[model samples]
Target: MRLKVLTCLVAVAALYAPQASAGSKIRVETRTYDVTGASGIELIQNINRKGPKRGFMAHAIALTAYSASWDLVMLRRNGSCRVRQANGTMDLVFTFPRVVSPMSPALKRRWSRFMAGTHAHEATHGRLARDMMRAAERSAVGLETTDDPSCSKARREAGRRIEAVSAQYEAKQKAFDVTEHRGGGHVEHLVLALIKP
Candidate 1:
């Protein structure tokens, strides 16, 4: 997945303290497809039926697709200090396949356990995104410009800081995924558990 960057600049007549904000916002969205199967093995096959035979593609077996973006709002008025408010949004999308509702008790129990593991795995991605956003926001909120008439330099530096923080977080995400997807890792364990019957 690719990261989309959208920055919005706004100047308002207000002043904010030169300190990090306490709160940040996070949003999550989930989208699912349909898969039909009667048994655990069948379910796995159905989930991966349409998966690509290529590299680094998230398929419906159990996938988490996420992206984080930020909106930088700067406030400046005549004879007033320039203030910045950074709002970061992390969107996490979990794509799965729908299974049959009515199934045997034993099958249902296994399915439930598998789903729990998948959900937990995806939740980690969301959590990481949220943490990165908060760090970016904190960095942006602390920026200050001494020259009131020319705040361009300050703005540019703040933008760079935010970008750098995001880049670092992205690296962390890649590393985490590598470990989780390695042989006998969490993802593999989840799959094995699902088809253990």
Candidate 2:
């Protein structure tokens, strides 16, 4: 009886050991948007899905920069992928609920911009999240050594690069907003401006 109980306990411990070890890993959630109508729910869903990619990517890079900070990753992507209504106004606009995090003030600012960048920026977050998750998984599986200083440095560098790209995206967003409000009526230019640097 003692031997059987000990074996059962060992098996249970083995089953849970990996789970306990991986508790610190980040979680990521991604949503894709395709709105077929102008329904309010559909519009909100579309915007929410599209608005967070760049910000999320920026957030990831920030985490990599510090080599700390673990939290779930959320990415929203897809742009104002609709055409002008017959009434000649924006067919749709996107809005995502603000996220509150314990990140530093600087990180918070970057995250806000990233969240506010063009819808396409969300796609960047999706890509970055995948890459980060893969790296984390590899480390967890023992394929990569987390303790390597080189690994830490590489992550920091990658974070910085992503931030630079995000900044450009932000600037373009600002420019587009300006041109849009001026009644320039340049649809193609506005779309291009949103996604391009």
Off by over 4 Å in 1: 1-23, 50-60, 75-83, 146-150
Q: Where is the poorest 10-residue window by lDDT in model 1?
A: 1-10
Minimum summed lDDT over a 10-residue window in model 2 is located at: 1-10
Clashes of 1: 0
Residue 115's lDDT within candidate 2 is: 43
Question: What lDDT tens digits, residue by residue, belong to model 1 across residues 51-161?
Answer: 322245545465555565555555555533343677666666666656854667887788889888877876776677777788878887747766565556556767787
RMSD in Å for model 2: 22.3
* lDDT score for candidate 2 against the true structure: 0.30
**Per-prediction TM-score, please?**
0.77, 0.24
lDDT (Cα) of model 1: 0.66
Residue-by-residue lDDT tens digits, candidate 2, 1-197: 00000000000101112132322233333333332213323333444444334343321111111122322111111211111010100011122334332445554454344444433443343334334334432332321223333233333433343344434534544454355335544423433343332
